[model samples]
Target: MRNTLIGNGVIIQHGGADYYNANIIRRAINNVRSGCFPSHLYPKECADFVTALAKEHNAALNGDYDRYVFTTYDKASLKDFKSRYDRKHKHSPEEIGFEDYFLLFELIHNKLGVKNPERFEHSVVLRRMFLDSVFNQGKIETINERFSDGFVKWLENNDYIFTTNYDSNLDVVTRLPVHHLHGSFNTLSEIYDPNSFRNQLKDDLLDGEEVDLNYPHLYSTCLVSYVGDLKSFSMTQSSLANIGMKKFVKGYQDSPDIRNQIDEWDESNVLVKRLKEAIRLKSERPELQHSEQYPHKELNDISGALEIIGLSPNNDGHLFTQILENENITEIVFNYFSHQEEADAKRLFGSKNISTRDVREFWLDVDNK
Candidate 1:
């Protein structure tokens, strides 16, 4: 069987609230709220925090207060941090949007730059944003190229299978057996270019672009329409309509068998058949399949050597844990970036044999190290 290596929040420069980036912001807020400095301290304290954070994250901190609210903390220095968050946080609820939240996170990251056990609650929000494609991860096409090369390289060099709770951008480029555990981001609304899905878009896809392989089918200029005039819109028409329909249906739901059949709908779904096909396709490629079963085939031989990174082993996800436990598979590798994360994962999965690593080192190649 071939080995498997997985990475989350490693290659991407940004991540959710639990992410290394956003947590910096969370830490700063917690620090200020917890008396890291006296309440009477000068706003310069905020500046200092931002500068320290910039140095720690290696992000350049730039932009005035107004602009800072919308910026993702990329690479800012102390000077940069001060310039951004030295203002008051007195905006009304009306001024707050996704961008405000993103910027507020940036402020927090800049402020908590040096505090120990940095809290990036913003990064947690950021992670959820990514999951939901809130701000769409800035400059879609360029990011996609960056991510694609990284993913393909990992798949080709590392003899491993990857399971992503996110979508499957890797499958399109690397053609590896990527199991999209929650579906992908490949959709028409995810790109900046109008003709993203067309072959023409591939011309723009350089060696490491961050394509939204799951959110939308492809990157196109039309995706910008999805974020059109956020202020005027309470919720996207499509999303609101779906929500209304869901409420209506759930209020008067059907039976389990009907739902099961609906879930098993043909052509669009193709789960059981897809797994069967994937198994058949790999039968001839034992070296690649790693002896794991297809969807229908029993995954009995798989020792359940689950390598979890950038995820909470919460009760909501207990079903996945149960899958492994029921199979008597014990070997596991759980990696986390912070003290809080470590404590959380430990509480859920226990301290036994769970190796912890910083977010920075979580995805590094062991062989290379």
Candidate 2:
């Protein structure tokens, strides 16, 4: 029956029903706060405080974290938002975000504060992590089943699939291509592979600064560490309203734009170099441009009935703009779980005459009941 699910061509966007994912500001607190610094970082209390703080910023929004970022990004733009994040810690940006609230509440401020002489030139040591989970690979099967075999076959058959996910777990049954809009690992390995966090841990996080908490047991293994570590790869400062941030490893001078000052092995720098390498290899050979499958083109051309699973609109404004304004998209589907999410989707789609449906969840027995 799902073969009939789409009467037209469909474009898929991966949302939070993901292998390892977090959406709201409270749920994501543990990632940025990390066991790395907070010795006493536990769920019940931290969650209570974050949930309360999120409520204070916008009572109507409750604890919907995206509400903060979406408004901030809509005003400042991601690039400007990121470029000005260091300023958000001390002076407020034109638009405030969740990160600003953290500073406003004095939860994340350090000893140096805004007075550091080099603060003007230094950027936060942003991190991108893909946590390896024993449960990650198995979710692909559940996802495929929830999506339905008929639906999966259609995506595979037409080469119409694109994911923000950095993993190729869909290849278990897929033959064609699954475009990775965000970055992916340069190697061929399951995301659930043990080495993901283990390789990252060896990179060094110790700086001279004092940490909020210290738990040595968390450092002993990849499994425990993964639980207390960062999982998101793309929450940048631009969406953060210039909020203050913590660095992964300490010693640094000069901006990322300054190549001479950057360490060759720095993790954040490495992500930058990968993109540069990708561009450099593709740039010299103009002939390959024609043959290369540009993900942007796929996005620009996204038509038919659009099914948005769990894709967050925070960091991916460019892609959302294309689809949001695309006249060719006849219908839209939001696989949302709560009344809050359904209302959020309606607001997101505002004034679009095209029919949009909100289904509760893919895994639920009754999708829309």
Candidate 3:
């Protein structure tokens, strides 16, 4: 029988939950509290928005709400806010909405040039230091090397690979095609410029214009939204920008400069267009639609069994459901980290036509054999 391997963020030892919480989320909180960006570089409106956002996030981190607070708001608060937002706007709270404020800050920073380029350069260096502390290393690299070596050999011998991670560790370790469902950090620099929007937004008259949206990364746009179990919103870039403007900008939508910038970004944004097309296709063909691009379609087209590693079905219920219902998938192996995860996998995929094993145990068995 044929087989396909799927992976998620947990596969990246040092770059998983721990790294994100420490380097990205914690760093953001600390930066906001300490005023990492100079006041001179911030316009009054942008400064006020960041200050308010940071304050709210600080309150949430202090444990003001009972539920896992991934961001500045407690889960309960987020749910309520989402409910109100959906009812008022006639749309659901998307996963991308959570990161809108952060993206807005990045956009504003680019719009207003840095007051001191030297200081900004120093800050970038310092920021990289923090990221490196979590990402660069001995043990993590060793594990990644081993996993990639084994996994790539298996894929080349048979089947395909799909992952829902943002890192390029898999790409670096193997020459084989490993599809990244989520945007990757490696492509971030190519798609976005923190200092200016010239490369991404500006149209070159000499060059034949083509918006390459496929394999689009995070840095491509200020508006980013992800659809999940909750009611999905229109994934178009313009729609998302409107949602963001309403949520973050308050009365600034009337500003010509802000409107023009958003419009330019929307026109050039390949990711947004891609997502919109996916949404359209999903609507037209729900049963066959697996995910935005490759994950869903490829999984459905698989002629054999599937092996899942480190992916939680909570955020990807639709994809999981599709896999279970696909007649082409004759068997499934779930490699989980914990008993609870195993239980959850069983609950989702069921006992029949499915097998469960700890990730470590599975790897050890593979190595020993």
Candidate 4:
């Protein structure tokens, strides 16, 4: 009763169910505030947090004591610290996630004083994160020095990669094309000068005098933009208003020439055109374009399969579906983490070529292939 791949014409649509897999701001926040680590207030609350998180998503421990070693404290300093700490600290996704979250929090709470403490107390871990003022303040620059090639190496060991097309060469030949979805954390400062504003103001105000205001705002804004709620323009509006941004917004909004120029600004520089071109070329000649010599293109083809992996399937990229349908894809293999996701994928693509299975088995089959 199942369709099968019998020839080159038969497109074998295989999709691995993956989360966005990025250490986004929200995941980072929950990792820090999840109370996974013991505190004076919640002394025996380790398993509770870990268990809850595990039920929600899959976690792998390459080493047992990894978490303990990484996040260790002086046990001898305390009298009642009897539980054995693993000390191996394998850098859980949550752990890395927390660090990213805390950096954003520091940008906002420490620099911008713009955190919703009330929301923090009420299942904050479960809520969707928004790009806040701290993000708009450019705090991402603070972590630039810390994010070197070494971090990329560590991320490879941990199965995390940058999704962006630029920033580093990142052995595109062998490894899973670690797409740093966002721009590189390090290049951010160079891309947007941290002290550009202060330097300009000083130049305008003092003519030639040496004026230096520690550009913490620059760092804060970078971080804020990285983690800010892009859907709402309120944060940027308030941010601009605070720094006398009325003229800039008005000029951009009012001047016809400015508006015309703005339309040409490719502000995000998302590389959509390049991707579309690649897809068009690949679709035209799948044999040549999908060759092993072009791993990035192959990955793109994999990502563009009828069944999506980490995507939420809001149909934002309906073209992928159209391509699959037009090619007459009769079957799709999807690895679902839970029954709910399997049911959901089935409901959404039931009329098409989608079949859900356990992630573990899917990987096993992949290995054999």
Candidate 5:
């Protein structure tokens, strides 16, 4: 058995699931209807704006022309929104999101000759709404003790573990050097904290611009994007760093106090320091190093086979492509949720270096073995 790569489906299958994105949308709509902000930390202005937006959204959903503003609003932009959504998701805009609602508000507000669309454009209210919703809805108190213990032991035996999950369930269960491909909630917490080194640098750098102490989640996304871009640049000779830098600069451009935070972060951040060390190790020992930046690097570095648990290949084509192309990956054991998923995995990876088993059965076998 080779080192395994676990995905979000593993956590979900293990009873550590959270509310789906659809549920998030519904929760936000419900919150708006109730005239309440998801978090009590939000201001009255934000609450009122969101509530009003929700009323319009509800009306649109119900095709209530008298209540909805679609007819009088920017029809072109609304059509564009629908087209874009359909193209990206292969779904209709009728099933929109919190972000989409904000976009609609911007379109309608612009049409109504609202002089300052910035009120909706740069508002941190939507970001806060999402942060609060996910934080509240995705709380994982505990995992099955037997399963947790068994999984931890399995992780201990593995050479490396890579995950795309943002939750802290794995962190609570194991002390292994599990690389989080997607940003984690823990990272968000660090970025949001006023006392954190990153935030401290921001505070010192922004001259007199008042920091919104209540809405730290808004900045967390930006910081996460920055780190992700930095990591991508380090792994590949991509211009993602430049793009990320531009975003970082734009995010704090108004404040003159701290313009060098991004440049300074490389030297000051403990995580960045560790990442640099990992890069150095990779340079020194090509065979031994497992990259924290690129998931493909770790997959390619594996000397043995690869085991994929609770990941659908269809949703992760990039990762699947890497796995299929990497000659070092001698075999692949994929855990499937259903027959269709199993068939999809087989079709993607082929029968030569691949096998499939039910996720539940796979876990039970692993625990017993």
Candidate 6:
């Protein structure tokens, strides 16, 4: 199958996708207090953490803070951002939304430059801003241009699409299969539903059955949306590095203390163990079983050439690493929008297996053809 990776950049040009863009999310974040946060996101234990941070950030800024929030895109350099922000902030079990802020911003913010508010706990009264901004975004849509047309054609040829975007912009416009690497609003919201068919399959998914998705891992991973300029990978080092999945790293600690194995986690003990077995069943287990029954895992086993567009090198490190290591994938066609991005693609993908293209040229050809 031919495979293509669609990134956030291509959809940013579309109007419907503007809802989840940083500006909208940021504005909502900077505005609400909720008496107790979004009706859905706030834990009864903690009133509101994320909303309060925005209020405080607002109080601290004598002038507009927007000018400064976006200035430092790199997390390493963000240390010098403010003496107050220098220290690493931690989240408690009640402070779940704040940690989520760190994770989601990396995936969705793309370039809108959202800030990981310093001292998330201080904003306990902060409204749950993500759901507020995301849930109300009417309908997300994308059109048949800018490779959407070409992507549609490729679907007929059995090409696979893997996108890091959380919105169903492509799904709305094309109704094609889009594997959202970090998860999306639709999937996440459905899992929350008590009666949804996907939610009903939760147990089967956990039991390593050909059943769809349960919670502890994949569901937890995608439904989670945190708001950050901290960069997605940098924010969740504890989850990915410690061998615990980032989505399950929600617990009370001055800093997140994730375990190296699933057996150690006591929260959803059984489901967690089953999640490990499920992943193990699909990941390098002796049987080489599970196979295509696991469609998400199959995203990695791309055998034909890969055509990539709009994917950020920083968003999903582990997946990118696998793509680099996969021998089945013939060549990576990395598309860039500018000279600087061309340089970034060169550094990230290297020359050994990748050939670069200017996005404008490629799509113009597609639209022309």
What lDDT does candidate 2 reach at residue 69?
38
User: Considering summed lDDT, which 10 consecutive residues are worst modelled in model 4?
Assistant: 3-12
In the range 11-95, model 1's lDDT, one tens digit per residue, is 3443444333354344434444555432331222453444343332322223333333332223322243334342344332222
Number of clashing residue pairs, candidate 2: 8
TM-score of each: 0.35, 0.40, 0.49, 0.29, 0.55, 0.52
Which is the winner by lDDT between candidate 4 and candidate 6? 6
Among all candidates shown, the one with the greatest TM-score: 5
Backbone clash total, candidate 4: 39
Those runs of model 2 whose alpha carbons end farther than 4 Å from true positions after fitting are: 1-151, 157-159, 186-294, 312-315, 351-353, 358-369
lDDT of 4 at 330: 55
lDDT of each: 0.39, 0.36, 0.45, 0.32, 0.54, 0.47
For residues 1-369, could you state the per-residue lDDT of candidate 2 as single tens digits? 010112101213222323232332322454435542232323324434444534443422222232333333222432333443443243312134433343323211222254333331121211111122212322333343344465455455442566554434454456666555543332222122233321222233233232232332222111111110111212221222112111211112223533334334344674555433333333333222211212445655656666665543233445556667777766666555456666766777664533334443343433232
For the record, the alpha-carbon RMSD of candidate 2 to the native fold, in angstroms, is 13.5
TM-score computed on alpha carbons, candidate 6: 0.52
Q: Estimate candidate 6's RMSD in Å.
A: 12.1
lDDT of 3: 0.45
Clashing pairs in 3: 96-225, 96-226, 290-296
Per residue, candidate 3 scores C-alpha lDDT tens digits across 1-369 of: 555555544445434554443344444334445665333322224324434444443233343433333343224334533442322233211221333333222323333443455444433333332333233322233445545355556555555666655455566666667665443444433224332222323344214433333322322221122233221221123245435434323322446675454444552566654434333333344332221322345666776778887676444554676677688787788888888888878888784488888888866655554
Per-model C-alpha RMSD: 18.0, 13.5, 13.6, 18.7, 11.1, 12.1
Lowest-scoring 10 consecutive residues by lDDT in candidate 1? 220-229
Query: What ranges in model 6 sit over 4 Å off?
Result: 16-21, 30-128, 141-151, 154-158, 172-176, 188-296
